[model samples]
Target: MTNSWSYSSTDNLWKPPATIIRSLINCVSKNGNLLINVCPDGNGIVPEQAVETMREVGAWMKKNGESIYGAGAADYPTPEWGRYTQKGETLYAHVTDQPIGNISLRGLRGRVREGRLVATNTDVLICEYWNPEVQTLDGPEDIFFNFARPTAWTYPLPDESATVVAFRLNDDEGTRTERQRLDEVRMRI
Candidate 1:
């Protein structure tokens, strides 16, 4: 998704692997799809740079594909830090930029049960707050998520391009089955 189809001498304009990873998550969050074109050389061979980048992307997918594989667009607005993707009641926050203070997700409706960093598979602090001053017409109890850094991972996050935090939410009875499945998966991990 970064460069031209055929090879050009100046087409060394390949995007970094991390950028591609972020783009993939963003596309999934927006209910879209990504098609990365691996440009071949004049001799009909893929470039080494492109191959390396794809390998890096594959490595990332191995750890965090759950956030993108079957996710749909989030119902709430995107937060300042990044975009969001959802599967049933579960939400995945794709943090693309480093926040100044805390990562805040606004206008959420479901109750969050648990949150964890997809890369590290470790817990991330998820706090809900009720601010009367900033209350919206949506409801008196406007859901706001204060995603704090967990002790398990570094504060600023090691991944610069994107860091994913998966949140298991409780919204409806149908989601209970999914929640139980997530719980079972967590237990196995």
Candidate 2:
């Protein structure tokens, strides 16, 4: 509980903006909803700290609300770096941690039409044909996207709260490559 019905000195455990935002994203991704209770003091005044926290959350929502509102649980499982939420053919990747390399979406059966950072609308690399040898052995096609930067250099994420990457999917679902099929046949033979 963030606050009580009435103000108490020790009742509130104030969560940081990042924690609140991350919680909101995780709940939305898992086909769940979060209900926050904001209690006012005896004078019917909201706490300044609570208001500030909400302001930060509201700011993040102003930019990345599309990912949460009207979104359903993604067809795929959650990735190491973050969770995924889908609306129609589009999948939103809520990256909570700094990715070591490219953000990989394993077993993503949807073809990516485009991808971009939700906050800045900056284009991220959507490599469908990346690492053909590795992908062939993996069986299913994986979608990889992120700023193609060297891992040696430390780069800050666009938003520490949660950087959202929007991936517009195609109507045609992903499939195994011909090479993979041939390899399977060979193994069976």
Query: Evaluated with lDDT, which candidate comes out highest?
Result: 2
> Would you give me the overall lDDT of model 2?
0.74
Could you tell me how far off, in angstroms, the CA of residue 5 lies in candidate 2 after the best superposition?
Answer: 6.3
Q: Candidate 2's error at 102, in angstroms?
A: 1.0
TM-score of each: 0.74, 0.79
lDDT by residue for model 2 (1-189), tens: 365655776776887888888888889888898777777777898888889999999999999999999997998778898889999888999988987555677876356667899888988765443343244435256656656543123356778889999988876544656565455434522
* C-alpha lDDT of all candidate models, in order: 0.69, 0.74
Model 1 clash tally?
0
Off by over 4 Å in 2: 1-6, 128-140, 149-154, 173-189
Give per-residue lDDT, candidate 1, residue 106.
67
Tens-place lDDT digits, model 1, residues 136-181: 2344233333334321222575467678888887766245554564
